[model samples]
Target: MKLVLDHIGVRVGRSMHLDDISLTLEPGSFNLLLGPTLAGKTSLLRLMAGLDHPTSGKIRIDGRDVTSLGVRGRSVAMVYQQFVNYPSFTVYENIASPLRLGRRLSAAEIDRKVLAVAEMMHIDKLLDRLPGELSGGQQQRTAIARALVKEADLLLLDEPLVNLDYKLREEMRAEMREIFARHTTTVVYATTEPQEALLLGGQAAVLDAGRLIQFGATLDVYHRPASVRVGEIFSDPPMNLLAVAIERRGSGVVRLSPDLSFPLPSHMRALPPGPCRLGVRASHVALAPSSPADIAIPATVELAEISGSETFIHGRHNDLAIVAHTAGVHSYRIGETVALHLDPQRLFAFDADGRLIAAPERQPGTVSGAA
Candidate 1:
């Protein structure tokens, strides 16, 4: 089912929930709705699912206007962050309920379909257990199983893995990707996590303050953000933004700061000298070497957090608080002073109005760079 939201708007009393949002979701493709809390991700999903009415615009599926259709009239299934399951029914029965609704399916066929989805969800061993008897992860798996077993044409998952533990969330993300790849359903997933959006790569629609900021292929959106706000939203540690004045010299030298400057890239020399914002990702910030880059700055380390295979170093550079992501285990004490290197080629420059003025060249397999 190809779903389209044509200039949809939702207003509740005096508050506007969504404002003139427009998007088209291709059939059998995974679409990611990304935003922060109260950014209207859920409200937009509800509009598509017919759980709420849009105050204006229209909703269409495959060229047919379904704006008037209620939830019961649509072939859709939704899974929420909080697991929703029948407390009285066992896992097997819960998954089979949708298949048995107003249809005559033999017990053998029902069992086959139910068990298939249960195994796919890694909850086959808990088939006879009730919701109360299962762990939080298991219970959520049961809810997901129930939703997938129906084989609905449209699947809406609203942070379905958010309730799981860290390890379980990682495991389930990979599993869900595999399951979705095998099915041809049009899946729409809403998430506030930038990593999750990248992990479930497809198309992405970024929302902010009930407005659709940008939408396109996930990698394209990440690499070529439309604005500074979009770049900040799509970054994990958040993009490091710095206020700087650009000074263009006749010799092609561009000064970014009083003490920092480098030869401007061939394409950037055309920019007029003025004030702009520089955006750099944490991964692009590196520890100073004996022979550092020309744009190195002295900074004092404030904090260091080591997790898994990376260390996040937070420090202060002049008046700016900067974060650097480095691979492997590293230790840094508070008050330690270190020089940081900034690669001009990997930097992004935004105009005074927060519009992207320059973007770094695209490189494969590099998710952390200018946008």
Candidate 2:
């Protein structure tokens, strides 16, 4: 099912839910709709599911117009954040309901399909149990199993495991990926978690406000965000941005501060000397210098947020606030002076309008220097 959204936009009353969004999901392609709250992730999913109509543009499945169609008119299955199931029906019955309603398969075939998906979801032992008899994670697995049993051409999962605990969510994500690889259905998954998108390892359509910000392979999009806005939204702690003045020497160079400066990346050699923005991921910033070329910026610790086995040190480098995501839980008192080391090679460059002009070399697409 080649899905195409031709400049789709959704307007309700005075608010616009989607704006001039155009995208294509190849048949059997797994894609992620990534954004924060009110970023139009759900709106786009609803429009794709045929639950909502676009105010403008068109939608096509396999080049056939389906813009005006409703959910009942398409071979689409959707699983929401909440675990939705028939309260009175057992897990097996719930998984078989779609087959029964469509009247497209015999009882024996439906039984086979239901059991297979149930096992795949690791809920085979709970088939006879009702939704109320299962744990939150089990109920979600049941809901997902039901969606998978339908064998719908398109599957929309709107944060299906969001309600589960941390351990359960991690477990479910690995299984979900394995399941998705076996099915040829075009999957459109929506989530607010940037880590989830990265784990999925597929193409990503990043949304902001009501507009389509960037769309491409997940890692490519992550390493080379089209703009500062995309970088900020795609990052977990958000990318740290520093305003700097670019000064071109006889060759290529940039002056970030009186004591900090480095040669311009190869890609930015032709950029005129003036005001520009530098973006570096939190993971790239360190509390200690890693190399001789590293720039040590003196900062006062503002906050030290410890999550799991890592600590995110929030510091103020003059007027700029930077977050350093480092391993192990480290303690730092407020107003403590620390030098944040930055690697010039990993810096992302952006222009005055907040658009990215040069991206550093990254994995898989690795180059000798910055390009």
Candidate 3:
């Protein structure tokens, strides 16, 4: 199904949950809605699923207006962050429930569909078990299986793996590509993690504070964010931002401090003079200088967060706080003096209005400083 949301806005009394949101989801295409909590990811999904009517604008499914349609009238299946499954019904019956609702598929056909979907979700062995008897991951798989068994026209997943354990989440993440590849449903998955958006490698629409911020191919949005806000929201640990002044000297010069100044890259040549915001992804900020041309700044380490095989070093360069994301475990003590190296070519130049004027050239797949 082709899902088209035209200027969709959801207003509840005085509060705005969605503002001028417009997107067209092509048939059989996989897409992602990424943002932080309360960013209107769920609200947008509800609008897409016809669970809630928009206060303004229209929603069209396959070129036909469906803005006034209710959830019962559309061919849609949604899985929430919470594991929702029938506690009393056995897994098989739960998976078969949707098919039975139509009262069209025979018992034999229902059994075949249920068993097939259960196997696909790796929950075939637990078909006889109740939701109460299964592990959290198993229960979620059952819920997902029930949704998938129906093969609805649109499948909406709102952080479906978020409640699972780390290992289970990782396991499911690996299977997401293969699992979705088997179905023709227009999949719309929501996530707060920038890494998950990249890992999924689909079209991504970024939302912020009830507004649609940016939308495009996943890598394009990651590599060339439309604005400073998009960069911060789309990057893990957020993009490091610093206010700087740029003078229209030879090749243009940006002065970070009295002692730090460098010629801006050609991409930033069109930047308006005077004050500008410099954006550097945490991944591109190196811990040490690779060459003399690399700009080095002295900073005091504030904290070091080690997550499995990765380490995030948080430090402050003067009043500007920065986070450096890198692979492997690295230790740093509070108050330790360290040098951060930044490549001018890899810098992002934003206009005073926070709009992106220039961005580092796209490189090979690298995000959160991980390969």
Candidate 4:
């Protein structure tokens, strides 16, 4: 179903939970609602599911107004972060319960549907086990199976994998993607993790403090953020921001700081001269030899953290603290001096109002420094 939120706003007492949010979700597309805690992701999902009402604006499905419909009135299903299940019922019974409600089917048909969804969730073997007898992940899978069996027009998942173990979470993420791809249901998934949004590879709507910050294709938003806040929120280690003055010099040179400067690309020659914030992803910072297009800075390593496949090196160049995300395990001691290379093409510049001014196009064969 095509879902539309027209300037929707939710108010609880004197506090506003959602502030004039407007967006249209296409049918059969998986839309990710991404933000940190208290960013109103859950509240927005609840509103879409008809569990809550908007104080202003309208909610439409397929161009028809459904603002007054309750949860039971809409063809929608929801799964929360918490594992919700009927403790007394077995997994098969739980998944079959929704199918039996307000509908009549032959015994064979019900059994066939139940077993199909059970197998898809990888809980077919645990069909006879009660919720109390199953592990947390198993119980959650049963809940998801129940929701999927309904074949609802819209599916709302609010961090359903948040409580699972790291390995299980990774496994479920891939499985969920495949399941959703095969179905025609419009899905609205909520999560606080930026990596989850990227992995899902769908349209992303970034929410911040009850407001919709930016909405677009996932990779487009990541590559070219609309604002500094969007860049910081979408990044894993977060985008490194440096306050600098833009000096338009002869021969297309721009000075960012006393120790850091680079030749501006031809496209950025028309940039107005003034104070601007330089934004660089940690993955773009390197310790390798400087290429002609790279800006090198001498800095002392303050801390180094090695995490299996990658190492995070925190260094200081003059008064600026720089973070270099390098591949594989690397040894570095505190106070050790090293030259950090910054690729000119990978840099982002933001105006004084924190709005993105320029984001250079990513070139082919460009290596990501951050894991």
Model 2 residue 287 CA deviation in Å: 1.2
Q: Over 4 Å off in model 3, which ranges?
A: 364-371
Worst 10 residues of 3 by lDDT: 362-371
lDDT to native, each model: 0.86, 0.89, 0.88, 0.88
Candidate 3 lDDT over 122-194, as tens digits, reads: 9999988999999999999998998898899999999998999989998988788788887999999999888
Error (Å) of candidate 1 at residue 271 is 3.0
- State model 3's lDDT: 0.88
Which residue pairs collide, candidate 4?
A: 283-370
- Give each model a TM-score: 0.93, 0.96, 0.96, 0.94
Error of 1 at 270 (Å): 4.2
Q: How much RMSD separates candidate 1 from the native structure?
A: 2.3
Q: Mind giving the per-residue lDDT tens digits that candidate 1 earns over 265-312?
A: 654665778787888888888885424343677789999999887898
TM-score between model 4 and native? 0.94
**Model 2, range 1-371, lDDT digits (tens) per residue?**
99999999999999988999999999999999988889999999999999999999999999999999999989999999999999999999999999899667887899899989898888999999999999999999999988888889999999887899999999888888888999999999998877888878689999999999999998888889999988988887899999888886777677767766777766677678899999998988988888898888889999999999989999987677899999898999999999999888788999999999888776574422110
Question: Which runs of model 4 end up more than 4 angstroms from their true locations?
Answer: 364-371
| Cα RMSD (angstroms) for every candidate in the order listed | 2.3, 2.6, 1.6, 2.0
Model 2, residue 338: distance off in Å is 0.7
